[model samples]
Target: MTKVNVYVTLRESVVDPQGIAAKDALHKLGFDEVGNVRIGRLIELELSGTQAEIEERVKKMCEVLLVNKVIEDYSFEIGEVAGK
Candidate 1:
């Protein structure tokens, strides 16, 4: 099995309501040092395939369903499973 770590974030120009809310909440909690907190998602997928194949498939998956290309950006890391 291979593990793919997909990280998805909003484009810098896009406004993130969730991120803003969280930052505001943090500030209310006395965390004034936190600034411009941008929210993102981490998607982990496990599959069996060669590294190249896995990367190709995951990239397609990102383009099709895992990311919103118009407002978001993404990056991924692929690696072998620890015990597989």
Candidate 2:
């Protein structure tokens, strides 16, 4: 089985209100070093396939369902599952 880690994040040009709020709260809590906080999501998927096939499928999945192409950008890493 192959393990895929997908990361989805807002484009740099997009405003992140949740990140802003979290940063402000952190500052109020005295974490003064915090700066330019941005929030994102991670999705882990496990599937059985050759590397090339998995890559193609993952790219299609991202474009068709996983990622928002307009406001967000994504990246993925493929690796072997442990003890598999």
Candidate 3:
């Protein structure tokens, strides 16, 4: 089997209001040393399919449902797992 790791984050040019808000909230909550906070999504999948097939399916999923391409960018890594 293989394990795929996906990371999704906002593009550099995009303004992340949520991140700013989180930083502010953290400051008020006594974490004054905190700086910018950028939030992202991570996903892991275990598949028994071939690498090529998995890549194709993952690309489709990213374009259709996993990410908002207009505002975010994503990268993924796939590797064989030690066990089923």
For each candidate, what TM-score against the reference? 0.93, 0.94, 0.76
Candidate 1 similarity to native, TM-score: 0.93
Provide the lDDT at 66 for model 1: 96
Model 3 lDDT tens row, 13-81: 999988999999999999998977998889887776788998998888899999999999999988777
Whole-model Cα lDDT of every candidate shown, in order: 0.93, 0.93, 0.89
Residue 44 error, candidate 3, Å: 1.7
* Model 3 TM-score relative to the real fold: 0.76
State the lDDT at 73 in candidate 2: 97
Worst 10-residue lDDT window, candidate 1: 75-84
Model 1 CA lDDT for position 53: 91
Tell me the tens digit of each residue's lDDT in model 1 across 1-84.
888899999999999999999999999999999988999999999988888899899999999999999999999999667566
Alpha-carbon lDDT of model 3: 0.89
lDDT of 2 by residue, 1-84 (tens): 889999999999999999999999999999999999999999999988889999999999999999999999999999776457
lDDT of 2 at 46: 92
Which residue pairs clash in candidate 2?
A: none
